[model samples]
Target: MAQQVNPPRGMRDFLPAQKLKRERALAIIREVYAAHGFDEIETPVIEDYARLHAGLGGDNEKLSFSILKRGLRQEQLENAVVTGTGDVLCDLGLRFDLTVPLARYYASNRADLPATFRAVHIGPVWRAERPQKGRYRQFVQADIDIIGEPGLLAEAELITATSAALARLGLAGCVIRINDRRLLAALLDYCGFNAADSDRVLITIDKLDKIGVQGVIDELRGFGAEFVTPAVKLEHILNSYSEAACAGDIALTESGIAAVLPADLAPEVTSALISLGEMVAPGLPAGVRLAFDPTLVRGMGYYTGTIFEIAHPGSGSSVGGGGRYDGMIGRFLSQSVPAVGFSIGFERIIDLIDLPPAADQRAVALIADKAVDPAVLLRIKAELIASGARVQIATRTKNVRPLLDRFELDGFTEFANVRPEHTSMHDLDFKVFAES
Candidate 1:
C-alpha cells in the first residue's frame, strides 16, 4: 500500500489559478489601505509563549499552537508532568492573530516610528481548534491599526478605510454594526447583573443572533434565580427597541440613542457613539450603512472602548470586526497609548467575491513543435518576453485542445504555434484564446 499524501488537516494548498485570484484581491486591499495613508509593516510568525498567553488575546490564547522547547531531557518532561505544569515545556507559540504581534512590534520600535503611527499588516495566523465549513486552523488576516490616537477620530478613520477596501473589492451592502464596551457594561449594570459575571454574560449575549432573545433569557435563568428578573427585563427592553426601530422611530442621533436605552445610562458613552456615527457616514461608499447595535459584544476581552463588526447581507456570519484596545500597547510599553484597529476576514470575503485576472500583464503561451530547434525556441521566448509579454514554452502534444484549455485556465491570454523555420517574433502568429 502507498502512503497517503495530503496537506495537514484544517490547512490547504492553492492551485495556480486560485493563488492568482487571492493575490489580485489582496493587491486591491493593499492599494486601498496605502492610499488612506497607512504604511505596511511585518512581524515574526512566532512569539514568546508568555507574551502569547498574556491574556490580551482573549479566548484565542487557548487556541494558539505552542512550540516545544528544543533539547529537552527526559527528566525535565517527567518533572513537568509531576508538577502538572505542562505549559512550561514550551518556550514559543505560533501567533493566533496579527494584533498581538503588532503591539509587540510597536513596543520594540516606538522610538524610530512616527509619533502617531498608522500601520497595515497582512499575514497568516494559526489556531489549534476543530475545523468546519469556512473555519480553518490557519488563515490570513488583513489588519489596519492606528496607534497614539485617543479620540473618536481613530474609530472613524479605521471604519472608513476598511469600508473603502471592501468597496474597492466590489462588495456591496456592507453594514458596520458599532457599539462601545462602556455602553455594554452600562447596559449590564442597568439590568442588575453582578460586575464579576459580566464577561460570561456578555459572551452569551454575543450569541443573540445565533440564539433568540428568549433563548438568552432561558440561559441567564440557568445561572441563578437572581438572573431571571433582570434577563426578563432585558428581553422587554430589547423587544421594545426592535419595535421602535421597525416603526422608524429611532435614529443614530443623540436624542434617538437616548430614547432607546435606559435613562440612567452614562451620557458620555452614548454621546461618543453618536459622534462616531456622524463622522463615519460621510466617508462611506454608496449603499454601505453604519448602525448602532447594542447587543454587539465582540468576543475579545481586550476591547476597551468602541467595538464593531462588519455584516453583509450575503454572509451568514460577520465578514470582519475589530475594536479599540487602548490598554494593549500599555502592557508592553509601560505607559498608556491609545490604539484601535479593524481586520478584514480575508478567507470569508474571498469566497464571497469573484474577480477577473489582473489585466496589466499580458501572458502568452508558446506552443512549439518537437521538430523545432532548441535554439529557435529559446530565441522566440526571449523575443516575446523582451516585448513585455509573459511567455511560456510548451511542446506540442498529441492533442492540442487540452493543452490550450489548460493554458487558458492558467491565465494565458494568447497562444502561438512555433515551427523550425520561425526565427524572429514577427514570424510567429499569435491568436487570442477567445478567438481560437
Candidate 2:
C-alpha cells in the first residue's frame, strides 16, 4: 500500500504553470509598490495567539488553525474535547493575514522606521477553512501599508496605488466600492441604534451578498424591536443609492441619505466623501470606477474609518478590499499609529485571468541524440548559456514530444537539438504566427 500523496485539503501544490502565474503576478505587484516608494518587509508566518485573537480578523478569526501547545502535558491532549471549548489547547497559530503581523512588526521596530513608512508585504497566510473549488486554506496576499500618516491622505494614497497596480495587471474600470465605518456608525445612530450595536449589525450586513435582504431583516430582529427600524430604513437608503449610482449621481444620492441622517453627522459624512472623491478623481486612469455606497460594510472588526472593496461582478465576491485601521496598532503599543492598506487577492486574480509569464530571456531547450558526444553537448550548452538563453538539456526518453511539451509548459519558446553527424546545432522558435 502507498501513503496518500495529496496536499492537505483546502491547500494547493502549484506546478510549473500555477507557480509561474503567481510569481509573475507578485512581481508586477511589487514593481508597482516600488515605483510608489514602498520598501519591502518580511514577517514570520507563525504569530502569537494573542495577536491573532485580538478582535481584528472579523470572520477570519473563526477560521484560524491553531497549533497545539508544544511539550504539552500528554494528559491535556487525551482529556481535550474535540469541539467548541477545544480552542483552549492551542498556544500559537499561523497568521490569518499579513496585517496583524505587520502591526506587531511596526510596534516592535517603530523607533527605527521612517515617520511615514510605506511597507510592502507579500506572503502566504493560512485558514482552517472547508475546501472549495476556488477557495483555499493557504493563499498568497500582497499588501501595502502606510503607517503614521494621520490624514485621509493615507487612504487616498493606498487606493490610488492599488488601483494603479490592478490597472497595470489589466483590471481596468473595476468598481472600487468605498464607505466609512464612521458612516455606518452615523447611519445606525440616525436610525436610533446605539454605537455598541454597530459591530453586530455590520457583521450581518456584510453577509447581504450571501444571505439576501430578508435574511438580514431576520438577523437584525435578534437585536430587539428598536433594531428592526434600522434594518428597514437601511434597505431604502441603499436602494436609493443603487438607483442613483447607475445614473452617475453619487453626490445627489448621498445628499438624499443626508436628509435622514443626524444634522451634524450628515454634513460630516457628505463632506468627507465628497472631498475623498475630488482628491482621487482627477488623476485616476480610465476604467477604474469609484463609487460611494452607503451599504459597503466590510466585515473586518478592526476597520475604524473608511472601508473599501474591489468589485468584480463575474465573481459573487470582491476580489480585494481594505480599510483604515488606525487603531489596530494601538492595541499593540497603546498609542495611535495611523495606517491604511489594500490587498489584491493573488489567488482570485490568478483564477480570473491569464498572467503573462515573468520576462524570459529567449529561452531554448536543447535535446541531444544519444550518440552525440558528451564533450560536444557540454560545449553547446555552454555557448547557449553565454548567448543569454536559458538552456535545458533534455533527457533520453521513449518519445521526445512529451519532454518538449513539458519544457514548453515551463516557458521555453524555442527548441534546439543536435543531430548526429551534423556539423551545426539547429534551433526552432516553435511559435506559430498567422499570415499577416
> Which structure among the candidates has the greatest TM-score?
1
Give candidate 2 misplaced runs (Cα > 4 Å).
82-88, 242-265, 357-360, 396-402, 422-436
- Which stretches in model 1 have alpha-carbon errors above 4 Å? 241-251, 255-259
Q: Write down the TM-score of every candidate.
A: 0.95, 0.89
- Residue 145, model 2: lDDT of 91
lDDT of 2 by residue, 120-221 (tens): 999999998888876889988999999999887887888889888888887654778777888788778776667888888878877776776667778888
After superposition on all CA atoms, what RMSD does each candidate show versus the true structure? 2.2, 3.2
